[model samples]
Target: MSNRGGVVKTLFKRDFVYTFYSWGFYVVLFAAFMISSFILKNFLDGIREEDILVSAYPLNYPLFISVIVISIYLVMLSGVSISREREHGTLEVLFYGPVTAGNFLISKYFKDLCLGIIALAFCAVYFYLVSLTTNLGFTAGLVRALVMGVFMISCVVCFGLFISSLTGRTRSSVLVLLAILGGFLALQFVHAALIGMEREALSTPMLYLRETVSHLFRGINWVSPFAFLNRGLDAVVLDSPLLFGLNIFYAVVYSVIFLILSIISMSLKGVKA
Candidate 1:
């Protein structure tokens, strides 16, 4: 095999072996399927609309489930990847090897991405099957949902890799990953509240605030794999719609930037080790 082929094979084998042997991966898949199934069932019954609207919650059920799933996966994967290696003391060995920082990080990241793809595939397949059984056909909303799902996976993988590179301790990395994700999410809410409060009769402040907050929310939603996938699925795929132009762009750029940074950080740290 050529270099690209070799990379694929190596990454694929790693992803397949690691995820398959891990109970966590199965739990993720099972959870995703159950969530999607429940959501589909609600849609078919048409009663979901009443409950959601009556509650006045901003999130739809499927979107909410996807966000929770992606966030959990990202945090869990970050700790597992680094913590396991640290426990085995393999990270020190690998650092001393001939492997470059970029290659090493990429190999590991690719493994995470592959696992994410598999999980997302499970979500897609379940939705499809459910749709068939219920006579509810696939819609453009689902396409948006899947696209967001892929983007979210990429974001999570990159974030996880970055966290993994920061320490040899898996627990520490997982904590940091959770902190970063949670901090950003909380800040978005704070931002919306701040903006919402700036109303005045002459300023059209509330109107501007609402639109501005919505835009910011969308921006963050796209940048975060967890948030973006759900938003895209809800707005673009299922209900009141919005396109993810800048959100998509930001997400891709952020993932690339972090992946590169993680590689550089690992490379420097590896040299010291």
Candidate 2:
């Protein structure tokens, strides 16, 4: 147990420190904040009254956009890093030490999770400045959304790692990640659109299509990180304790299941295979 503990500590420190100092993380942070600033600027511009009920408001939309943007980058980063490391013989070298797939994966998961939290901290600071400038005081809703953001990030990175574990090469990982995420987004978009329409307005074929997509969406609730994101945001927005707690529980279960699958996938494939 002590040996495994040491292994996780060593690997976590090594990878975390390296990635922390890398320019990529900082670059992503700048990009996310820039986009957030652009969004809030337009939003404030539209409502140009000083006393227009701007104070003590929720910045959920900008925050939502920022989280989605950062998540896309982090997901790709996780997938590519794992796949590339495997290709370059990094994992093989690490495995020769006391490292096993389980601890190694846990280290990766935590390293990325910590990075996500750092990004969220930057988010807090960025939004704080926005609140100060726009006189839109950050309220409890933003805080709740940020708390929900943590679990969303976990599910996202774990999903990326799971995809990476299933593929051998970095190129394959990238391709698969894009394809799968694209499909998931398409499903959500079409599903929401169809469901928003009046039931009587739909043609016979459209009704059947909506039903099919509905079933598919339900099937993917457990498999899709975006589904988790949607549920998390809904729970926070509703301000329901029951829904919020349930979302957290579901996120944890989803993350754990994916992490275990990633470890098992790596074990089955071995380093070089």
Top candidate when judged by TM-score against the true structure: 2
Whole-model lDDT, model 2? 0.87
Candidate 2 structure quality by residue, lDDT tens digits, 1-273: 698888898888999999999998999889888888888877787676553645344578889888888788879877876787888899899889888989988888999999999999999988988888876888788998899999999999999999988888899999999999899889989999999999999999999999999999998888988788888888877889899999999999999999999999989988873
lDDT for model 1 comes to 0.64
Per-model TM-score, in order, reads 0.74, 0.93
User: Of the candidates shown, which would achieve the greatest lDDT relative to the real structure?
Assistant: 2
Query: Cα lDDT of all candidates, in order?
Result: 0.64, 0.87
Evaluate model 1: give its TM-score: 0.74
Which runs in model 1 stand beyond 4 Å of their true positions?
A: 1-12, 42-64, 198-227, 230-249, 271-273
Could you give me the TM-score of model 2 versus the true structure?
Answer: 0.93
